[model samples]
Target: MKQYNIAIEGLDNGSFQQQGCDTVLRAALRAGIGFPYECNSGGCGSCKYEVVSGEVENLWPEAPAVTERDRRKGRLLACQCRATSDLVIRMRPQPEAVPVIAPRRMPARLLEVREVTHDLREFRFGTETPASFLPGQYAMFALPGVSSPRAYSMSNTASGGREWHVQVRRVPNGKATEVLFEKLRPGDELEIDGPYGLAYLREDAPRDIVCVAGGSGLAPMVSIARGASQAGLLKDRHLHFFYGARTPRDVCGESFLRELPEFGERIHYHPVVSMPGEGENAWRGETGFVHELLRRRMAERMSECEFYFAGPPPMTNALQEMLMLEHRVPFAQIHFDRFF
Candidate 1:
């Protein structure tokens, strides 16, 4: 195996090593370097880097962030590139002041599981030592006899206790969800790793916060809401939370949203039901896409606010497109996490 040295400029001249064909981003992660990234699948542009020297190959030839101009300028998506030779690159730096906990892989025992809604279940995993994670980040859980680990965001803020909380939405025939919803029980042991993703709350932003979540996407939003409330970040800023579900039966976190009153009028909650099912209906809440509701509520103020959204691809993509194209919200003011 041919191994080459990798240097990341502007990160204190940090360096790591990668075997031939390994991406620079993977090398950094393996070396415990907390480089900025989201959606490590080469979709999000958070890992864009400028190749300073040596050869590398783009794994995704059509990376969205790498344009013809960018290719001419020697820029590539770190998540989509592999070092073909010893290389020097400068990646977009993560927020210097952000508190990013290093990831660790270890065993955790299932402590409890309960249905939070018709299709969502709250999972509690107990670790030997208290696990610390930024609000809005996720951990990967590998069930017994399962070959691949499944990633789920924590639904609660970091705590001194040794338990991690996650909410999972059952997917049709999904192996992990099948096991979680049917065959898993308290006291079952599972392996977990992380505190990954860069979509955590930026508590220092000077603008109001608007967050949108759909289905189990409410997990990280739960963490952000509670953490912001406890940190007093909502005292002077308005927090408009919009959660969407197919029907009222799919809605979770009603009690969780009810607690926002503790933060006073600055905090607001809007639960949207997109497709109310036929039960001889009596649903009273905003109806239609959550982004449409957001456009109706604060369309004019989007430019002045910081937006955080996480959900299935279609919803998140639509919302992001609306915010960026229609509302003209600055790209810097909007952040997202998509559960694919």
Candidate 2:
């Protein structure tokens, strides 16, 4: 394997080595450079940068994060490009963007797979090294036969252990889910690189915590809630957990959260169904979307708490609009990594 030098145009210490076939963002992050990025899958456009004077190979030219205007401007997503030669690039670097735990590729073995819902499954993997990360950070898995890696949030609290768990929903005709659901089996081997994403539990904040999740987005929210319990944050502060699904069958989280040692009155679980079918007449919990439930239940104290949410773009976007635009919540108070 060969290495290429990556020099940032303006910063004095913005130099790092890009290992063979590694994306620019990964290399910078591995080198402890705080290059801005969120959703390392190239869906958020946060890792876009300019090629100052170097040759690079674009991995996903048609990535939704990169627009025609961005391509015309020669801006490339650092997570989607690899340096072909020694190169200089330019991107805004924020000190806070530095990863809490630097990511490195490691081998993991599938330990177990449990059914969570009709379309969702919980996967447990055992890594050769301890899988350490913040409670809400995500890991990128390199599945066999997949051209690009897929990101999944860790569902378990960080315990400096060798076990990792993620809940994945089967997407219709999704290449990654097809492999994850059909081909992979217990004892299978795969590569995982992560501890990425900026959305994690803020233990220092004195305010109550609110987590909104839908579909597969439940993974990180569960981790956040568990972490809060483990860290004793739930002892004094309330954690409002709102989860939404299409039908009663898709609803999960009660069993998962109840397994936590800190499950108590301080933690409130609100499960809602958006479109229950005719057969789901027995459904008696909250109805409508999760964001609507959040707004309805916590509308008065929206600004008094910290919000963390993840879901499909529509759900996340709706929550963002309602929280930031409607309720006047500060941008810093809400945390999430967009997953397209």
Candidate 3:
């Protein structure tokens, strides 16, 4: 078998590598390069990748993962391919490890609940057992009769690997938040499992940070900023956050915004509104798509910074594309969690 050197555009080092024209999606993962994917079956093209090098064997001839355009362009689903030869492929780059937590279902009592906005709430839970998690991780709150799992990010800093503060947005008809707002009371016993997702601040890589959050996506970012503020972990890096909301009432954790630098002297906060009221005439900020705002500004810093994104799936998708395509950020530098 002939061997060919594979060079990734932004990846600096190559260690254990996967070679072949059609290496399975699992192959890259096994090689220490984990690509975000779901439903590894061909039906879910999450493993979509483009071949940039040597040829590979196609194991699944009829694999539905390859699209007509993708196939034409030499893009193949990693799971459907079998390495016929040495190869180099291009797929979405992975982000710095943001801390994946194993959620434990524990009974918690509501210690305190604060209204960060008209509809946004920050609930602090004290469990009989220490609920440990990273700052930007999440917890799943399961209702008594409801089968769905509602994931909420911890808005507080990680401390002693115990306790957490979760931020929740009250959707108009959200079953979980509705129950939280209407049925739950402080000191009430609640089923909570938490410390999930990848949204933490990387301690080893001190690159400048740019965090964008929409609606409730601010939870994880808030947790991150709060963590930075408390211990100054992000002390040397320039940290900036862009939070977009409908109106002033949608803005939560204003205090953090007010005293950003006090946390590390390298942090800044910018809040924007898509639609403001006559009374909010004093509001001074850009107004439009958050991605557009990011595109227009932050061009120079895009290359040297790390981006953390959370919120609606559309927002994350748009931000991901904008950061990669427009802002020219390597996929590895962009971190995100999708709220579907």
Candidate 4:
């Protein structure tokens, strides 16, 4: 691996900086610099950065992240470029608190596979590399023959580490997950590249947390809640995680969670169902659209707590607007991964 020195001109950081050998976006994200990116794939063109001088090796030439015109304009995908020489890249910095997990194209064996719900599958991978990530963040899991990777949130948040735990939802006709569901068994191997994404728990912020998730979205929320419980963090803060499901059978681990000592009061689990079955009676929990439940609950104490919304994009985006415009939670206090 050859060393590369990158001098980011016009940036406030400094002049000639030694980049050594690293992918451009991976290096920047590792430094806690907020590099603007979306899919982190060449598909979205979100991580496109201009080359001020020198040259770089495009790791993925046909990355969808950048357009042919931009590629001709010297605009290459940050996620695709590697520091091959003393290059000068004029790109934005990723924000602090964004832990960088350098991707490795390695083989991991399927350790355990469980169904969280009808549409969700909890797949565990045993990897030689350790996963270090913040609670509430996500990563991209790649498999062989798949042109693009699927994004899922980490179930364990261990920074200064590698990759640990994650939860993923199965899409209909989704090749990766479909194969993972049927053919993938313990000891089966597949290719993975990730430890990407942030938008996790803002521990530095002083406020209670209102986490709204659906289906597998509960993975990160569960991880963060468990972390907070273990560390006795946010003792004064209350955690309200409302998981949405169609019926009780569609749900997974609420009983297990309620058994945890710290979860009795400090944490509240509200499982809302859209339609109760015929035999299932005595339903006391909230019902209807999950966001409406959030609206009613958050509307009262909206001023006191911070909001972290996940799950599907439509729900998150609509809730974001509701929290900011309707409930009055400040923008700075609301943290969500709309894309993740």
Candidate 5:
């Protein structure tokens, strides 16, 4: 129950208290400081900072985002280190990265589980506190016996209630998915800390919205679409939703998006299969990667819209390349938080 003070080198009144063993990034974010970060799992290297003066415990020394040069330069990932004592760190902070609803850990109980696909399920949880988050934000779940928390995007819009929904795909032999798919049941208790990530819908933007999702990445995209419709943004802006799955059996976006009130005209849904197997004639839909479909459909309009996407690294990387490198879309127009 001890707390340590964390000081930012140059910013005025830029200091926050770290409670217990929380990471530097979480504590700073919890305090409303917009410290730069993306994955929060140490995958994006966006939270790199220099420890001006402090002793911290490295949580993941071999994190993929940390390179040899970063170590040599005394740079550490804020998400992967815990302050052992009062600390002084230096990093550029962006005011735009601050969260509208700061994160706090709370107890939650699983209320329902519905099957979305053979390997995917939708979980409904009731939390101790009202669920509040932007459409595309994600939460970190501390399962009963898992050593580390797993992050999953929320699939439901914030309704000022206690219910939170997330669609999860069962990962083969994944620790968190094993517990969620096999052992977790209704009434199970766990801890959830969230409303994190910066990829939420930007209602102020005048451009059209393009959402590209693959596999379980469909969760946040659903949230964005629903939120936009609810906020009347879809009335003026079109929402083009692109979903990619391995086969027809994996397709679920059609059903999910249909539930939205704005599914009819303004909402355009496109489902593509990446690998439908040989002689899979029963599946009649677009084939090839989702990014390809996005490029083909959007064409030159890609630069005239706002994009939100989530999926495996490969899919996200592909979208990033196609949008930024190929179409020359402004980096600010595309939103996503990297996670591995």
Candidate 6:
């Protein structure tokens, strides 16, 4: 039985003990150390880290985000690699560090659930203990009879209370969605854990912040934007939101977004539709994919602005590529959470 010390450098956050056989990221999470990551399956590059010291074995050789250049530079996807020895990895800052709170598990009871669109549902639940999380962070919930927990981002920031909210889409056979839409009822108890993710708004973000959200991805952006508005953070910073949907019927949370503009004219909103149905031609807003629309409008200043996005893999992946390769936006300036 061998355990290794995993030291994450450059943050006051110290080190943790990890089993030699487990991925560094997994061990970090299990150790309750807040680290940057999303799509822990290695589909997204959020967990890519430079191995400052020690060695690791690639547990998942087919990591899509790891490049040959990354390997040459000693970078590995933390989610796909297990530490072979005591390790020191230089990593990103923990988003919530004013005072960090480790992930916790608790019991939650379903309070209310309602359909928001043809495919989207809004759910309200109360945790057994009050929980606090960053605006764009998410929680993992294990429903009764389900073998695994499903992650859902909060639609609002942690209010330092027992209640929280999330928006879900009806995936044809998604375990949590099915349980939420078909079997779950108000007062059903479930196991919950987390407040995980790295796509949240940074306190030091530039004066101009751009958010692009597709489908239910708008949930977290709404949370960030609303939180900023409520805390008076938007007064000095410009907030621009691009929300996309497949059709008019798929749009959700218009009223919540509408209030953002009242924060000030600097708060802008773009609701784009990818496909407009018959008689929907009268719509005067942007069209096509959200990334394309953003490129058309902000291609000139993208390299200078900070960007955050949350959405389906296709949307987030394409947008990240477009911003980095085409717009020349710095990799460090773009943050994303890709929902699988």
TM-score of 1: 0.79
Name the regions of candidate 5 deviating beyond 4 angstroms.
280-282
Error of 5 at 121 (Å): 1.0
List CA RMSD, all candidates.
4.5, 1.2, 9.6, 4.4, 1.3, 5.1
Order the candidates by lDDT, highest first. Answer: 2, 5, 1, 6, 4, 3
TM-score against truth, every candidate: 0.79, 0.97, 0.69, 0.77, 0.97, 0.77
Model 2: colliding residue pairs: none
lDDT of 6 by residue, 1-340 (tens): 6899888887665688877445677678767765667766677677888888898888766678888888788788887777788988987746442124566667899999877788888898898778778777787777777754677888876767787788888989777778889999998888777767767767666557888889888788888887777667777778878888888777656667776654447678877888867664545566788898898888788887888888888998899889989888888888777756
Off by over 4 Å in 4: 1-7, 12-23, 38-48, 51-77, 80-87, 97-107, 157-163, 190-194, 246-249, 274-285
Best of the two (4, 6) by lDDT = 6
Report the lDDT tens digits of candidate 4 across residue range 79-154.
6787767777787665642455544455677788766667776777767776656667666666666755666777
TM-score of 6: 0.77
Better of 1 and 5 by TM-score: 5
State the local distance difference test value for candidate 4: 0.68
lDDT tens readout by residue for model 2, 139-243 = 999999999988999999768789889999998999999998999999999999888989999999889999999989999999999999889898788998899
Best by lDDT: 2
lDDT of 5 by residue, 153-222 (tens): 9998877889889999988888899899889999999988887999999999999999999989989999
The residue-by-residue lDDT of candidate 1 on 213-273, one tens digit each, is 9888898888888878877888788888889888878876667767765544777888888
Error of 3 at 106 (Å): 1.9
Question: In candidate 3, what are the lDDT values of residues 1-340, reduced to their tens digit?
Answer: 4334444545666323444331445444545555654333455466677667766666665666567887678777675666555556676656542125433457888887888788888888887776677757776676655544466788766676556777787878777877777877887877776555555666556688788888988878887776666666565667788888877557555575555555436677777777766663645667776777777778777889888878776788888887788778887787765555
**Rank by TM-score, descending?**
2, 5, 1, 4, 6, 3
- Give model 6 RMSD, 1 decimal: 5.1
Candidate 2 yields a Cα-based lDDT of: 0.91
